[model samples]
Target: MNKKPDYLAHAVLLLGMLLFIFPIWVTFAGATQSAGAINRGDISLLPNLSHLGIFVRAFSFGSGLTGSAPVWHMLLVSFGMAMTIAVGKIVISALSAFAIAFFRFPFRMAAFWLIFITLMLPIVVRIIPTYSVMSDLHLINTFPGLTLPLIASATATLLFRQIYLAVPDELVEAAKLDGAGPMRFFWDVLLPVSRANVAALFVIEFVYGWNQYLWPLLITTKGNMDTVVFGIVQMITGDQLIPWNLVMATTILALLPPVIVVVAMQRWFVAGLTEVDK
Candidate 1:
């Protein structure tokens, strides 16, 4: 038998990687050029070293003639919202999954299925009713309001449930033998064991919450509450001579934190996704 590598497969993957990296390269190059150079079509694929000030301004102040809050504030709100959503989903989903996985109760399957159904429903589908509920609860312009409605998710719960189910019942038995109650077992054993999974899921859920636009725009009427993702876009959407270089600089700033997070947690994240406890 002859063994040969698929050169075509490698070529295709190489093409895909280039396709992904191309835009990022272009954005970085654009950030270094002046707005006049970009508008005049004098832009080059190679990044110029002359325009570091664009970044400083982008980091130091809000965009333009309007008295919008600073970019730093927008970034702070974005990080705060992302952290809240990631942690919120993990806690709620863990408790819900723990109950569904270990307990024998009436309507247990029904409850699990209900949560699973939420995965089928897109946030846009329920936006109006969700907004109505938020309004009734007077949660608008609040951090909880920005995050809580979006936390109506089932993915993390489902992931946690799978991990819990795969854990040996012997651990529960051992805990019981050791006179550990449910809460104690959870705090002492289950949570510690699930740390990798939680870290993995945090990276994902944080990105999801950070990238949210529509719901945040709808609920956040105040300029100060605008997230970096939305605020940066709002800078260039009008019929004005927008500062393209500054816009690109803000884009780079917006992408950095999440990229840093993914890079930092990559080892644990890969493990969490791949490993199934026995």
Candidate 2:
């Protein structure tokens, strides 16, 4: 059975969809033209097969990013950074959550609150001190430098903690009776049970890491270490004459990985986010 849609709701939805898609459509259209055409403010919604070579150029050779490394290399770096951040966040958050949820210790609440408090202080706020620490450690221009500072995630820990809290005490008792140590219980029981949440959080953290700009721009002195996200910014180095075609190509490339992750895992991602199991 179908019901008639509210006109107001339909209008609002259409408007929102247009707002979301207009920029992307414009980018796709611009990506198929010459830099000169785009620079001249002449763009149309027609595909230019001749301009397809621009994508090849952007991939095989670097564009306006002033980097000798190709866009593919930047993609690889972004993928590595994103994966490291996602996995690191999950591992640390899971362990921290397990400790807080299952163990009774001195200052446990204090430690949890301290970590939670950090959620208020974004990376921007601590950039100076964080950069100093990274510099002192000689991590600048390094992969670790780009990622390690960003891995401390209180939100993931909180999410996992909430999930763990919802688990039944009977499960723990059953595992205890089966001679399962804390590590054994966590590995064999909790981890398996939390797979959906892990996948969900992976999607979130991966996108966050991939989209990072300011930190990567600051830490990576070498052009080779730049991420695809920053690579796009470098394409428009100045307002004098922007390379719109190449910029659009790079933008599309940057959008693909996260988009693929979301599309491929939309089922599990949505489920995990909306329905945490006990």
Q: Highest lDDT among the candidates is held by which one?
A: 2
The superposed Cα distance between candidate 1 and the true structure at residue 47, in angstroms, equals 1.3
Instruction: Tell me the TM-score of each prediction against the true structure.
Output: 0.93, 0.93
Tens digits of per-residue lDDT for model 2, 101-208? 999999999999999999898678899999999999999999999999888789999988998888899999999999999999999998888889999999999999
List model 1 lDDT by residue over 176-269, tens digit each.
9999999998889889888999998999999998998998989987877889988887888856788888888889899998999999999998
lDDT of each: 0.87, 0.88
Please give the lDDT score for candidate 2.
Answer: 0.88
Worst 10 residues of 2 by lDDT: 60-69
User: What residue pairs are clashing in model 2?
Assistant: none
Scored by lDDT, model 1 comes in at 0.87
Candidate 1 backbone collisions, by pair: none
